[model samples]
Target: MSDDLTTLHDDGVLEIPISLESAGNSLDGDSIRNGTDALHEVMRGHRKARAVLLVGKGKNFCAGGNVAHFGGADDRRQFLRGLAHDLNTFTDALYATQLPTAAAVSGWAAGAGMSLALHADFAVGEPGTRLRPAYPGIGLSPDGGMSWLLPRIVGLGRARTILMRDEVLNAQTALDLALLSELVDADQVYTRAREIAADLANGPTGAYAAIRRLLMTTYSNTLSEHVIAEADAIADLSITGEGVEGVNAFLAKRAPDFPSARN
Candidate 1:
């Protein structure tokens, strides 16, 4: 992976840094491209990353898109279309990944940055961390699944209020609204996030993936259909090595050692 966008940690954590000190860590075209490419590489088995950690390099997490680029683009329409396309693709990949994901957020998470952080299964933020939709403020519509995710996360009315009013939510508010999984000290954000990711990585990956799939389709499925899906999922998983091991471990009164860990 390119150092500019991401770095793979030895503990199987893929770290994508959203901050660029020179540009105040704002999202840029290159960062979007590189970060997405890195995610694809990991998903395709080109790299070994059991979990992903989205973070910012400096004090601020991400300041959203580079507005300067928007003004400078000779073909503003084409530029914006391409940028949004790449960002949407990246966010899609993030949501589809089998690996559990986490984020260590600080300072500001605005626009696409907020979307990216929200995509993670678990996001840890400090007390000072702030989240904003930031689209209406700049006369733009939501992208990167913000429209879909926000409503699901905070309900339709609250999501509408947030987007329409450009409400900036602090870490506590975000946590209260279920946007953040945990709130920690500024210095402990990354450490706590990584610890959570590592714990997830060591657990039953297949089961985790199954749960993600089930939840992703929950709203779309009827209760009868959902129960059938759940039954099928459990039946399928029951025969897997991890599932067998887990069952056996339970019966034997011992800890389960998942097959993924052995590999």
Candidate 2:
């Protein structure tokens, strides 16, 4: 990964810092590509990361794309296309990862930044955090799965209003709309996210992955198909070490020690 994006693996948590000094940790081509690469490495089992945490290094979590790059590019169309492709790749990797993911937001999460925050299974933000679509503000359409994720998160009516009106949401408003998973103090955002991730990491990692897969496929699958999928998933997980430990632990009235911790 590039210096702008740093990854730290500790205690089964993969911490990724989206850092961009000039743009306040905004999304850029290099950062997206590098960050995606890092996630790919983790998924390949290069590191035993049971959970992932995305946090910003500076004031704002992410200000979104570097708008200046658009104006300066000799071929704006090609530049934008490539940038979107890279971002899609990153988001795809994030969604496909087996590890549970969380985002810690302290300030602005605008445009694609907001999408990245929403992409996480869990998003924790402080009172000062602000979220905006930012696409309509710049006369551009949505990218980074904003169009798909927003409505699912906040409902179609609210999502339409927020995107069309270029509405900026405060932390409380976002939380009320179900855009944020949790709220914390500015200084405690990352700590709180890490705590949540650690708890997930200690649980059944395989079961967590299965849950994510099932949920992601639910919207598209028919009722009969979905039930069968669920049955298959549970049957497959039953033989995993973590599953066995969980069953035994419950019978024994003790905490389960998942085997993934030693990986």
Candidate 3:
């Protein structure tokens, strides 16, 4: 738990830990920039890693933008643009990552905090964890792909209610609504997430990335266009060496060599 916003570690398993501790008392201004920079560096260094596991220390996952740093900017337009840019950078990095990713939430995930958790491929929270979309509550709108991700996860009506009402959804309720991928005891959150990450690390990495590509394309694609895109992907994959190895492995009743992924 360093004063820096993020801590990176490799734990023998292919997945690495991207710990979000704190930058002092509050996440105020410049914290998001610092955090994102650190995360970018971590990602660059671990290009071969299979997954990212996000964990937080202290009472909450994050309390959103530092209010102390909010109103001081002289140019309102510049400030808003900077905020949007940073959020998009952070989320794009997360979503475009080749490996699987998971968030282990042990405490409160509020505002952009919830957005960060939602960005993960899978979110695992502790039993008593609380998640609040703190956007509308503070007269601010959603960012960090919240508008794009939330409705897809929980449907339009539920997403609207959560955003408009600013309700605090607990971990259990989050799981019930399909907003969370799993729930575990508070102390076991990171452990369970790590286990799952390890499993994904050892699984079909290329196939998982292909699935991610399809889902991302589906976001703005028409049905007919998506069908054409899918056909292209299927044809491309069929010619790939890994795809051939996978088919051979299945027929031979053996594990896939994934020769293309060999380091």
Candidate 4:
């Protein structure tokens, strides 16, 4: 049902577009399920893809929930609540994945879309890209991990101002706040993102996964605990074929061939 929502490329980049035919490219239950399932396949080794890339299919990256559907639901409360749950589940799945991830935010990344971008390890945007807390505009609190991700990426004070004021940040401001890793030409957003994903896919997969996990949990750990976690990570990775190959390559003054390294 959702096969079309994701495409795993031969270069090992899994591309998950924000939406299908949904209006404004807003997320739906089907799209969310499809995307999450795709990620699971990759993480479980059912698929060969080693990196994930989120892209937009239409004019806007995503405009948050389908507002018209919300207004027309027979049981608005139930329908809305279920939608939020599905979105949360999908966002959690995306965050939990160990693979490197990037998002090509070519156009407007409002509300849930903004949160989705924040989930990625890197976000490539265009000069005209815009972001907004579209949830408050609809009289709703944030969802799709927005509340948690914003404060981490942009400072607590900036995040508070952006969410409370519902400020629509332009590309420059978003980049300045570190919301966007870099900006490319509007036409090259996806291409550049794909290049990044492919490049990362060829590097040390296990090391990337370890770094991602450690970085995400650093805030929750004490100084000693975090140091031990970092130590454990290095100790574990040092025995992996990737670590051996990396060190050998560095000593030999050659690039590491992680894929060919023995597991």
The number of the candidate with the highest TM-score is: 4
Q: What lDDT would each prediction earn against the true structure?
A: 0.84, 0.83, 0.69, 0.85
Question: On residues 41-93, what C-alpha lDDT tens digit does candidate 2 reach at each position?
Answer: 87887766688888776878888888888989999999999889988998888
Question: How well does each candidate superpose onto the true structure, as a TM-score?
Answer: 0.93, 0.94, 0.82, 0.95
- Cα deviation of 200, candidate 2, in Å: 2.0
Please estimate how well model 4 matches the true structure, expressed as its whole-model Cα lDDT. 0.85
Compared with the true structure, the alpha-carbon lDDT of candidate 3 equals 0.69
Model 3 spans > 4 angstroms off = 1-46, 71-77, 257-263
Rank all candidate structures by their TM-score, best first, as comma-separated numbers. Answer: 4, 2, 1, 3
- Residue 88 of model 4: what lDDT? 83
**How far off is residue 53 in model 2, in Å?**
0.8
Cα lDDT tens digits for candidate 3, 7-125: 44343233322223464222333555655565565568743455666655555566665554567778866886787787777666665566677777768777777887887788888
Most accurate candidate by lDDT:
4
Q: Which ten residues in a row have the lowest lDDT in candidate 2?
A: 1-10
Residue pairs with backbone overlap in model 4: none
Q: Between the candidate structures 1 and 3, which one is better when assessed by lDDT?
A: 1
TM-score of 4: 0.95
Ten contiguous residues minimizing lDDT sum, candidate 3:
11-20
